[model samples]
Target: MTVNDGTATGTTHGSMADAELVSTEVLLAKPKRVVREDLKMPDGRVIDWYFMDTPDSVMVVPLTNDGRLVFVRQYRHNLKKHCIELPAGAVSAGEDPAEAALRELEEETGYRLAEGEELVSLGRFYSLPSETNKYTNFYFARVTWDHEPILDNEIEAYFDMSVVTIPAADVFSRLAGEINGMETAGALMLSQRYIAAA
Candidate 1:
């Protein structure tokens, strides 16, 4: 599943290449990469401020034994507010997303899944792709588990999380508008599609 779907991607007010053009050199250098702040315009090509590198990220939507979801609530300083988010983590170099999700589910929420029920790939984030070539893969998985808190390998602080036992019908009531992340919203929409078809 993907957002904007290309047909609407280019037609929309935003550019569709999902790729940003960076045409600067030797501004600054970092440990794993360099900093290229000068970007070029498409036609004549100009110079602007844009970072040359960033880390890949990942997020997850997890379901537990009692048919409830496991989400995390944390104070996102960047947003200067708190958010309700699904269990998520980063995909380390050379790590399979399925394995990463499993490890992350426990590490972030302390729920070791018994087995994964279904896996859904939501495609790449191409976040500000027009600016960088970084495309991080995001995914969703429905899993069943008997949760017993494992303090040693869990988030240090818990903000607010509930095993939301809402029916599937209720999931989409908040889509296409006020839902948080696009990836989660998209994957849940895909989940609804798969659920309806079956």
Candidate 2:
């Protein structure tokens, strides 16, 4: 038998099927998914693995005409704290990641790219290979805060998010200290390389 582990698209062989689920539990299901599986390992060992099978997400490294980056300061329940992060959201089923990046930018920061402006593709990466199948695509866009963005006020009752701006020249140091979200930090790093070459 072959088991793909549902991580990537391809065929699996040999020991891949050795880890058969003995028991399963669903912890969360919705905008996000969390599940636990008890698998019997190849060496006749059994272990439990918790996984978050979430949709792929997009992170926008949005910049303004004045060389400032747009960010979101939102309260994260799991962390029990507010985090400064890039404007990001999940890619809806069958939706393009580039489109998702643009949508998330406007929804979260009220910033839309000016006419003819385009998004620079940074890259994509796995959030946590060991625990989650969630990967994030990074994008860089120059935005014009010219119009008001009609946003969902109750997107998440406790997750109230506010827009924040930081000078592009000062982003790295800030990320090193104040911005703790790894996804945000990774997006910034990827954007920096692109900005430098352009």
Candidate 3:
């Protein structure tokens, strides 16, 4: 449940339970999507809640046969900083999360699953539970560098993205300092069991 004390009109105080969505207002649409949801609480209070209406996404922890982890270092305009993150993307409508994970891994880092290899499920997690409906399915793939990274021109021009690799052994040591994206961090953490066994 999304809890907010600040509303569009004023501030409210209380823990709302079993609130009904009364209405929604699309505040901003597209690349940075935001929506205001008016919820009717059981106490007859209608509170305005704001959140990002984001699609589900997929993140892949790509490991190479040589014990290296493929990563993407990209500029996030919102953060105005280059972030090192795992290969990830929004799940297109009607597309499977596992399929999207493989596709994103190849596109962002030029890594593909080795022959006879399949994606190992890492589980689904909320990107930002209190702010959006977006959830990301995580996967661990044993991959090999097959080709050059294929990034969309628009994204490349805007984000200046590039692929990078690090030893799997050193990844966990640089968690918060070198790699800070929430989704990326979660992906790596979830892949720990598989990485240990590999």
Tens-digit lDDT track of model 3 for 1-198:
334865444235444557888898999997769999899887778989999999889999999999999899989888989999998889998999888989889888888999999899988888676889898899999998889888887656577888889999999999999898888888888889888877
> Candidate 2: worst 10 consecutive residues by lDDT?
7-16
How many backbone collisions does model 3 have? 0
Of the pair 1 and 2, which is ahead by TM-score?
Answer: 2
Of the two candidates 2 and 3, the one with more favorable TM-score, higher being better, is 3
Kindly report which residue pairs in candidate 1 clash with one another. 19-129, 19-130, 20-129, 20-130, 20-131, 39-48, 40-46, 41-45, 41-46
Per-residue lDDT of 54-135 in model 2, one digit per residue for the tens?
Answer: 8899999988878888898889988988999999988999999999999989988889986788898988899888889988
Question: Is 1 or 3 the stronger prediction by TM-score?
Answer: 3
User: Which scores higher on lDDT, 1 or 2?
Assistant: 2
**Which residue pairs of candidate 3 clash?**
none
Candidate 2 residue-wise lDDT at 122? 89
Clashes of each: 9, 0, 0
Question: How far off is residue 162 in model 1, in Å?
Answer: 7.7
CA lDDT of each candidate? 0.56, 0.83, 0.86
State the displacement of the C-alpha of residue 181, model 2, in Å, after optimal TM-score superposition.
1.5
TM-score of each: 0.61, 0.82, 0.88
TM-score of 2: 0.82
Better of 2 and 3 by lDDT: 3
